[model samples]
Every structure is written in structure tokens, then in C-alpha cells.
Target chain A: MDDATRVEVAASLLEAYRTRQPIEPLVEKYAGLELDDAYAIQQHQVQAWLGEGRVIQGHKVGLTSGAMQRQMGVDQPDYGVLRDDMFYPEDAPVPAGIFLAPRIEPEIAFVLSRDLTGPGVTVAEAAAAVDFVLPALEIIDSRIRDWKITILDTIADNASSGGVMLGSTPTRLSDVDLRLAGCNLYGNGALVATGAGGAVLGSPLLSLAWLANTVGRHGVTLRAGHVVLPGSVTPAQPVRPGDTWTAQFAGIGSVTARFGQETA
Target chain B: MAAHEAGHLLDPGATVGPIDLRTAYAVQAEGLALRLAAGERLVGWKIGYTSAAMRAQMRVDAPNFGPLTDRMLLAGGEPVSTALTQPRVEPEILLILGDDLPGGSDRDRVAHAVGEARGALEVVDSVWRDYRFRLEDNTADGSSAAHAVIGPLLPAGVDLAEVGVTLIGPDGERSEATGAAAFGHPLDALGWLADALAAQGSRLRAGDIVLTGGLTAAVPLPSGARIRADFAGAGEVSVRREAAVPPSRTPADTAETGT
Candidate 1:
């Protein structure tokens, strides 16, 4: 895609994210849209946000799990940038109107102490760089109308990232084999979904390592003190106003986020 | 605290004069707000005076703590500029927390919560002139922390209790120590920091970078110096003191290189 088209597409998506209004998919509007074009649009939007003084807290990997990839009909994982403003404190009430079509998924978050540069980063290297792991809830929102999105569309939309809520407890990587780490998601205090960390590219560390390498080729450095959110352990579940969601990780702790009443 | 951090010289009375550790931390929080307003992002916390000698010199039974920022981090392979005042360097171990550790967590728990252990170079630059200050004064000054360079990371299970660190300078000046110099084990210092932060109603969150106290005495950071810290098993991290340049690739460079 040309730079002008990338900028224009980014602007439209940014507007959708800002106003919580869904728009038509770019795949329909622009013919022959490739993953590279979609990522270009996403990068343009990220640059805009950075220019506006929003801090880049870290990055997130998406669609790494078989469930999500199968559901999306994609064979590979995608990534998105996490801004500081997108974080919701644990158990805080999240505003539903801030998202177009919000959904919740359970995941693990890795906090890095040492920078991880990729293309040759190994899962062991990624594991060694992790400072701690926590249970997290990723609130995914789609900017495409009716939640319809191809891999390219979602990638352009920053991998459907909306908000993240982190648990208070941290579990060391050595204490639990992340591949077997289990998660149980509760909505309104009822168990609604279940998954294991193995679902995320065999292990969440592998997913993180994959992301570090993929973005490293583009001159991005997963620096020390950055948070990396691996893809969801469970399938994304639709959410709405007045909903309270909690995700509990085996060996880790639990995190909760509540949705407030809908705004007009 | 704000006046002190802005480079304003003040009598101890005008700053953290005769304050207790609790009040000193409150002052530190206020100063941290000013830093955040000035666009400095908080990356992690640092434990100071973990060594008995330093604590005894400061006449304190416990250690002090401070915050770390993005601007204060000098990555390995990056050059350190002479933009800081009275900058000194120390070799230390960094504990990267993968979990949220509340105050009062046991050492074992702290160790279990750690995800990585790394060799580190801490650039300590006291905002206070001459580095002459009381414990409270240093506490309010962010523990004299200026910048840090994190070397390669090792898995948490690796025994860091006795890992050796060797600091080699551009002129071949060498300083060496072991992790045991940091409160017996680096995890102990981490546990102490967790408690300190917890006392302030904060916990060590996941992704928080905690710099254990200096393993060896600090030395002057001279310009044109290349400082490297070699961790016995964790690999090495180095920083060169030279000119500062933007690390980002220019569009022209990208176009030319086709990267």
C-alpha cells in the first residue's frame, strides 16, 4: 500500500477506536490488501498515538492459540502495541461505551527485565528474560462492523486490543510449567470458560519469543521493563454493559474487571 | 524534593530534614509526581545501601529505595552520554519480577516470584552536590539513581547467590565482586524492596525491574569509557560513554538499506 493510503486507513481506524463506532472492513474497500499493508496501517496509527504523548507500555501477541487461529481462519499469530492508557487496574469498573464490540479473553502477561531482540531469540532466552508472570484479562474490541474481521483487518486494527486488567499475584516461571498452566474464566462469578497456557503456541514463552523475533526484524526492541501479553488461553467471549469478568490462573492469581452501565 | 531534583541547592532543613523513613518516602512520591509530569516514565524500583557498611555509614538499620525511569536506562550496545552530573558506575544484579510481590513476602517467595536474574551496571548520580547527604536526603533524591544497563538474562532457577561480576572499563580498570555482597543474596534485597514498597501501599508488580544494591563500590564514570559487566553465567552487558545520537533509523536510511 502507498503511504497515503496507509495514513488514510489508519485515520479511519483511529476514529473508530476513538468514537467507539464500527466501520466497514478495509478488505472490502481496498483490493489486494496484504498483511504488510495492514501492518503498515497499524504502525501509522501507533505513531499517531505516540505523537499524542501516549506511552507504549509494551506489545501483545494475538491468535497464537489454535482456538483463536482456527476461529479466525489464520495460520499465524499477529501482534499489537499496548498503550499505558489502555490499562485498567484490577477489579476496576471498565466503561463499555469505550469499546465498539468488546469481548474478554484469558491470558498470561510476561514482564521482562532484560531486553529481548529477535530473529534469533529462543524460547529459553525469552523465558530467562521474564521477571514474572500474571493472570490477565484482555478486553478485545473489533472496529469492523458486526465483528467481522479477516487476519489483515484485525492486524490493522491493532489485533483488536482494547483494554487489559492484570492480576495482583505473580508466579515465577520456574514454579509452574506454563505449558500446563490452567485458566478458568468467570463472568458474574460463574465459571464460563476454561483453557491452558499450552494453547498459546505450545507455551506462552514461545509466543513471546516469536513476537520478539517478528517485530525485531522491523527494528523494534522488546526492551527491559516492558510487559508482553501472550495470546489468549481461551476463546474470546462476547461482553456487554454491567458484566463482571474474572480470570484465575492455576499457580498464579486472579484478575477481575467490571463493565459499567452503557453510555448513550 | 522537587526543588532538590530541579538542581536547586537547599539546606537539609528545607528538604527531608530530620524526617523518618515514612515521611521521606512520602517526599519521594511527591518528587516522583514532578518527574512523571516532566515525561519520565517509571520503569522499576532500586534498593540502596543494602550493604551493612553503607547502611552503617548512613546510620540506618534498613535500606532506602527509589524509582527507575526509561530515560535512566542505558541499554547494552548503547552509548552513555556525558549529559549527567557527577555520574558514577556500580556493578549490581537486577531481579526482574514476573509476579506481584506484596510487602512482607518471604525470601523464598520473592525468589519464586523472580523470572530472571541479570548482570547490571547502575549509573549513580546524586542530584545533591558532592554526594553529601543524609539517608533521608538520598531517599528523597531517588537514591541517587541516574541510569542503568541490563546485561544478558539468565533463568530464575540458576543459583545467583554466588554469581561473580567483573566490571572492566575502557582503561582496563577492573572491579569484581559476587552477588553475595548484596544482602547475602540478591533476592533478599528484592524482598526488602517489596516490603518497602508495600509499606507505601504499593507492591512490586510484574515487569518491575528491581536493582539489587551495588555488589561493589562505585567508581567515577569518565567520558570515553567503555564499561562492561560480565556475569559468570548470565553473559555480559556493556555501554560506551561517548556522543549521544538518536537510535531510531531515519526514513532515508530505511529506504536506502531496504530494511
Candidate 2:
């Protein structure tokens, strides 16, 4: 896709975010939307949000799990920028009206101890950079109508990012084995799904390393104090009005997300 | 000279004039030598101007550091002396290092060395009259080092950015802010302190207390008044002022020695 087309596609996605309305998939509309163009489209939206005074709190990696990739029909993982306003507390009920059909997934949130520069960021380097890990539920919502999104379309939609709910407790990297950490997804008093940390590109640390190196090519340095959400352990689960979901990790603490009913 | 006299008589507008940070730190070293000679043992270090609240109140652009000593440590619920000139209190996050901080700008080392994060209130007493001083002069006065009332320890690996602080004044009124007010996160300030100390050929040792600046601008300390700051997820810290003395009023320094 050309620069002009990317800008136009980004504008539509931004409009969707603003109005909470879905639009046609960009991949179908553009047909030639390559990886670079998809990222350019995402950057355009990120810049626009930054212009609106919303801070970049961190970044989130998506499709890290084989289940999610197979579900979304994407072969590789992608990332999205997280804004400060998108964080909801684990103690409170998040308003459902904020999203246009949201899906929640379980992941490990990495809060960095220092700024990480890329290109040669290894698993050990990634491990050292993580100050601690928190159990997190990432509410992934797409701007593409009917949840129809190819990798290019999803990338253009900021990797289908939405709000995030984090647990109050934090576990040290050395204390918990990320590969063996298990999570049980619960919705409304019922077990919905189960997964292990190894589902995320073998280990979540590898996903972190992948993110650091990929964004390093674009001159991005993941700064200290920033939170990075590695991909979900299990596939995404659909959310409904008055739905209460929890992601309970074996060694890590759990985080809850409650969707409030509007009834209008 | 400041140890012998707490207050001074001078023009409030007068500045020591254009002293760089290097000169200021050197002067600070001289002051530290005198304290050490007088039998005070160094305990920790304090970084100032690390928070937007602190920087906005102090009108300084960059952060500065000063040494803390055993004599300046105060336990929780202790009575603060009213003798210090124009004393004010600030809520701060103190990181207790379990290991020696390796030199350089890497924040990973700063986090690894810190065994615990605690909430505390730092009692800052000014030396020159009316708390008036240039940036360099403030440094030489030991960044107004007075006492630290250590409060509660937060859970390990807890996010410092969300550490909400509620400072209850001598009066019933309360001022609120969070750890993010301190340079987005307290650890960032610690990272800066690591680099600053490294430049000075020093490193934070194991068991050292590192105060990561104030979460809020300073509030006045009054006689018989109890001030408490509640840090979310950590706990609360309180200090009571001695009621027997006048609350640091600046009369003409009757015994002024040209300070």
C-alpha cells in the first residue's frame, strides 16, 4: 500500500476507535497491504493519539500462542502500543460500553527494570531487564467488523489492543518458571480454558526478546518503567455484558476483569 | 558554621552566584568531612529534584544528591525537633539495597540490588534564613538533610508508579499524589542517582537506604502537630513535633557570625 492509502486506512481505524464502530478489514480493502505499510498505518494512529496527549504507557505483543495464531490465521506475532487511559483496575468493574465486542486473554505482564535497546537483545538480556511479572488480562477488541482481521489488518488496528487489567501482586522472574507457569481462565464461576506459559513462543521471555529486537529495527528503545504484555497463554475468550473473568496463574497471582452491563 | 547556627540574617533575594554542580558537590564533600570528623556515620544518600512536584516547587531542572547519616535517622512516631529553622516534611519512597549497586546507567542493576521499597517522610530543615538559597547553596547545606521516618515496606516487585501517597497535614486537610509524580516512577530516580554517584566515583553499598526524592512539594512543620503520610499498598508513617519550643521563627540572628 502507498503512503496515502496507509493514512486513509489509519484514519478509518482511528474513527472506529473514536466512535466504537467497526469498519471493513484493511487487508480486503487495500489488497496490497504489506508488513511495512501495516506498521505505518499503526504508527499513524499512534502518533495521532500521542498528539491527543495520551501517553504511551507500554507495548503489548499479540498472537504469541499457537492457538491464537491459528485462530487469527496469522503465522507470526505482532505488537501494539498501550496508552495510560486503557488501564482498568482489578478491583473495579470496567464499563462494557467502552468496547465494541471485546475478548479477553491471559498473559504475563513484564514491568521493565531498565531501558532495553535492541538488535541483539537475547533471552538473558530480556530476563535481566524484567523487574517483575504480574498476572494480566488483556481485553483485545478489533475495529474490523465481525472480528474479521488478517495479520495485516490486525497490525493496522494496533494488534487489536484494548484495555488491560493487572493483578495487585507481583512475582519475581527468578521465583516463577515462565515455561511451567499454568493459568486457568474462569468466566462467571465456570472454567473456560487452561494454558501454560510455554505456549507463548516456548517461553514468554523469548516473546519479550522478539519484541525488543523487532522494534529495535525501527529505532525504538523499550524504556524503564514501561510494562510489556507478552502474548496470551490461551486463545481469546469472548466477553459479554455482566461477565466477570479471572486469570489465575499457578505461581503468579491472579487478576480479575468485570464487565458492567449498560442495558441500553 | 551552619552546624553551630541554624538560621542566618541576609537578603532573601541574594544568591551565592552561578556555582556549577561540580563546585556544589565539592563543597558538599567538605561539609560531609566535617560531619564525619564530628563522629557521625554515613548511612545512605538522598536524591533531590527527582520529581515534578519537587522540581516545580524548587524551580530546578535537574536532580541533585546529598549524603545521609545515622544521626539524621528517625524512627516512626518519634518527636521531631522544633529547633531546626523552617523545617518541612516530604513523602518519599526509600529503596533499601540488599547488594552493592554496580556502577553505570543500567536500571536493571538498581532494581536487582534493592531488596525492599519503603514509604517514609523526610524532614527537611533549611539552613539559610527563610529557606532561601541558590541550587548550589542548597547542595552545600546537605540538601537540608534532617531525619527520615521509615514507614512500611511494600511487597517485593510492587509497581512504584501506582504507590499512591496521601499526606495529612497538621491541620485536617490532606494532599494526595502518587509515585508517578516522582519522575514517572521512583526507580527512575534511583537509576539517575546511580549514574550521579558513578560520576562521583562512588556507589551505593549493601544495606544503604536510597531516598528517591519527594512525592509532593514540602509542607510546613508546626509545633505539636502530627503529620502522617499514607502510601498505598505500603502503609502509613507519622511524626509528631515537640510542643515545648517555638516553631522555627526567624528573629534577627542575635548571635550572627556573618553567615
Q: After superposition, how far is residue B34 of candidate 1 from its true place, in Å?
A: 83
Off by over 4 Å in 2: A71-73, B1-259
Residue pairs that clash (backbone atoms under 3 angstroms), model 1: A131-B96, A131-B97, A131-B98, A132-B97, A132-B98, A132-B99, A133-B98, A170-B99, A170-B100
Chain B: TM-scores of all predictions: 0.83, 0.88
lDDT of 2 at B19: 71
Tens-digit per-residue lDDT, B1-259, candidate 1 = 4443454545566554687766777778887887888998898988888765356555556678899988778788676645565667777888888888888888788887887888888888776676777888788778888787887885446556546565666665554455655775688888888877777778888898989987656766666667777765566788766634446887998899988
CAPRI grade of model 1: incorrect
Query: What lDDT is reached at residue A21 by model 2?
Result: 84
lDDT tens digits, residue span A108-216, model 2: 8999999998989999999999999999999999999988888888898999999999898989998976764656677996656555676688679999999999999
TM-score of each: 0.51, 0.51
Model 1 lDDT, full chain set: 0.79
